[model samples]
Target: MSEATEVKKVGQTPVSNSEAVKVANTSGTTPVDTSKSTDKKKKKKKKRTNISKIENYFPDGVYPEGEWMNYDQDFNLARTTDEEKRYLTRDLENQDHWNEVRKAAEIHRRVRKNVEGKIHPGMRLTEIADLIENTTRKYTDAEDLTKMDDPTSRGIGFPTGLSINDIAAHFTPNKGDKTILRYEDVMKVDFGVQVNGNIIDSAWTVSFDPQYDNLLTAVREATNTGIKEAGIDVRLTDIGEAIQEVMESYEVEINGDTYGVKPCRNLCGHNIGPWRIHGGKSVPIVKNGDITKMEEGEHFAIETFGSTGSGYVTTEGECSHYAVQDYDYDAPSLPSANKLLETINKSFGTLPFCRRYLDKIGEDEHEYALNYLVKQGYVQDYPPLVDIPGSYTAQYEHTILLHPNKKEIVSRGDDY
Candidate 1:
């Protein structure tokens, strides 16, 4: 209903000419002292680069500059909203429930990780994807819920996000679609859910392109770099620039041509609070100076969506439903709220949710509870909006907390 919003940025303003010039001078390359020995000059230049100064990009402090997120209160409001919507939707006809959704998500993760880890090589994108989908049948209820002729109820698995090389992201398999995985393919898999009244959405990518390993590596490293640099005092834009700088340093080579990997300007990691998908304050992973800092108690998905084309990206001119955000709070509750909440509480609690629980909500208020659960961080899902063009892109996401002890990664499913 929000008009299928594209990736948006905030906390940015026009820079004065003087300011731009000063910033440019500081970031510009240093003059080479060719008169000195080549080896000595290289060492001297390295010392001058002063990687240590990178830490100065943030404000002096350990905590964020704003009020910390009240997860309990905020999530409760979000859950209530989600439940109201679920009450109006049709119920999933399949019996696999949330288990099936979880199975699919995990299976995809395994296959993607396997590819990233070199467990399988020369596998095409679709081959790897098929293996993941078929593997889910081994554990999930093997019913096609989205089929019209089938008597099975329409389930939440009707949609999925599959992004392959040059394709930023957001693709689903129709009744009989097939796409194969190929060597040097960078693959990204993102998914969502509607269990009970909760939702969970996430994504990650793998690269098989040999020439662009360093580019992929740089982007991967940037995820960690941005996370480490994130804090109460760090500007969000700084995170973007840092990632941009790292990726730019590496020449992105694909199909025998050298290119540059740009941070998908339109896509960045966002706040992950209860059912209000795309929470607040987009933390840019590519930027031009303006910044936003992380605060304690604020749960965020420090996701990295990178590309091998120009940093600027335009949408595909078409929009698809990925995850529905719950915004209605004053709506009346349906009979299924109680049952849905109960199921959600039992299955999800404070942990992330999956789509299988939608069936338990009794079809009436399933979507309503779905929104509520997402607010509770139960039914979490990643929005499918990435830059286009090029053959490959990579994504690495992790849910984290800005705590006093340290920045804690809540989703410990993967390292990157």
Candidate 2:
């Protein structure tokens, strides 16, 4: 029979008597035909496409969605009344709040994973920043938040920090940065993603040379230690002490020189509020006398930096990170500065942004205006936080949500 005829007759054709008897006699049992059953099974199977797989990440059936990260609950943190528990549960279960946070975390996790092992020795710092930011925009569907259906729904939480070597944090490339990565350099990749002002601030370190492996490991373990020790009503000092103990225990040897890792005392991770990266509380890396306790329903970025040089960071180099101040301030007298201020207020609000972002959005000749705003205390400028020259530094960070019932590491991933 022809191929088309045979395929058409698959489930409709009946077996001949001779064939049935032959099969029954050979097997010593009755033969059961399965063509119709097999055809039914095949018809029932749904064809999976790449679009379908992508759609699975979006729980709300929206485009450009992210998968939810795994979470666990800690019931032993603090005691709550039944009524309070119900209230807390309602907050935790609110899809509008927790789901947005999870989506942002997943976008961060995926963007970090996508850029891993892609940073080579000769790539420019600008290229690296673009790669990270573009990938984040693609995942969040906020390439141009102004044009989106909901302008403030999803976007970058802060400027992409590509701080290399002793440069610890708050560093990103300007419009024409020519800095190149070196094989011996230890680079810290710090970035954030935000959905409805809930930011997932996380970071990891990369090194091409094996000599700096311990540096990365030390900082990563320190951050993890802080995450583990954090809970409701846990004192920030205790968490810092734990982080310091774990960070200082390791020593790195480069070219027959042994150096102990020290936590960056000045660069403590801060709490994250709605549209606020530095919310009131600061989680120190070293034991300070700050007895502030982690409260319920608070979001914090537990970041740790370990350096071979001074465990302190000073603001140096040209400033790239800028954010509008929360309080009221006088508007600039210059028309250009006033226009730029309006743009900043409308585009970024309190979320941290970089100069390159302004350029991308077609804001030209904004240098003077931006500086004037910074000078007038209407906007805050964050220069590169550097440890010391000729030293190596590494950082690791994770954003956690302190629920009334459990502590959820929103940015937790397998890579770090």
Candidate 3:
């Protein structure tokens, strides 16, 4: 091609072919390489991909519906103010709430470490529960007010439940229960700590014998597996399914028999909120078709209770744990009922508190008080879980903050 095929000089007005020729000749530079320029133009036309359609941000199908990380773009707003951007992007508001949650979680972790550290094979279950609850008060800062709305009411949202052996959870020692831990027993302690009613629920099993070690390990792996498969907008069902897969993959040797492991189906981890322990949505150990999506700024207790027996647990013993019935109703006339109701509403709110927790309020007749509240529909008793006799159970848990980029395991440092 002739020089007339190109402009005489770059950035100058487009000249006629004859003028371009003269300008190129006088400029003392070779005629422009139109082919190279055309190649550069083609390079600049690279396709702009819409990241909203990308696959899951976390690998291994953590987000079942694929990662919807484009929250800002999904809203279909091209231009947004900085204030509006905080809704899509994590801001100080989010961090502020997380800070309190992390603080409470750390407190729970440390106090639990101190309490459980003293556990021995001969330790009484009642003493262990007392030790845990007392130590929790030592580390916590709960202040009861006349109403749950009071910001001052913050502390052990879910009281210590020192469940052992077949008891998967919801077992705290009553005033005179003389159960003791044996060398071969598997102990599962489930508890929660709250800061301004922001809850971080967690649990774990401890076994001294090497035989039951694998059961503890299986539950731990299942819990972590669930956490790994959790991310923003992930299907709640996928998390449960992944946990079940991992739990079943583990094999444990018990009583000279090799057994495959799986989580108890009836019991599950739960979504947590301020002043609410298990309300948002239940995260089952097995899939149950809950398509609820985990959003940012939400908290969850990712827990697994793996058992050597059938993957089912039933409440067959006395209820040692209690929670206020989360219904809108008026208080009853029984003096003991009103007394327990006031204490629950003031401090525990809708969260679960131990039957022994009433001791802190100087209540000795807990059975009658609880019974009164139960009959009045002011409280619900969480009965102790019983597995098939001779079969063992183990548990592992962690609290998580479902941020867009990743999940923050608030109680991650707790021993697995």
Best by TM-score: 2
| CA lDDT scores, all candidates in order | 0.50, 0.82, 0.72
Model 1 clash tally, residue pairs: 63
State the lDDT at 320 in candidate 3: 73
Q: Residue-wise lDDT of candidate 2 within 65-128, one digit each (tens)?
A: 2322222225452345565577565664665677678778877877877787788888899999
Global lDDT of model 1: 0.50
Quick one: how many clashes does candidate 2 have? Answer: 0
- Better candidate number, 1 or 3, judged by TM-score: 3
Question: Can you write out model 3's per-residue Cα lDDT over 1-416, one digit (the tens) per residue?
Answer: 01125436766676555555667677687766455554577686665522221112223322211112232323333224554555656535576677667667766767666765688888888877766665555455343333236523566767687887877888887777878788888888887777777887888787888988778887899898887777667778888899998889889998799988878988888788778888668888899898997776678888889888887988878877788886676677877778777866766668787766676666666678778888777888878887888788999888887654445777876265
The best-first sequence of candidates by lDDT reads: 2, 3, 1
Q: How close is candidate 3 to the true structure, as a TM-score?
A: 0.75
Give per-residue lDDT, candidate 3, residue 159: 68
* CA lDDT, candidate 2, residue 368: 89
Mind sharing the TM-score for model 2? 0.81
Number of the top candidate by lDDT? 2
lDDT of candidate 1 over 256-366, digit per residue (tens): 787776677777877654443356778887775665566544556677766776555555523323243334443324445445655544333433323432332234336
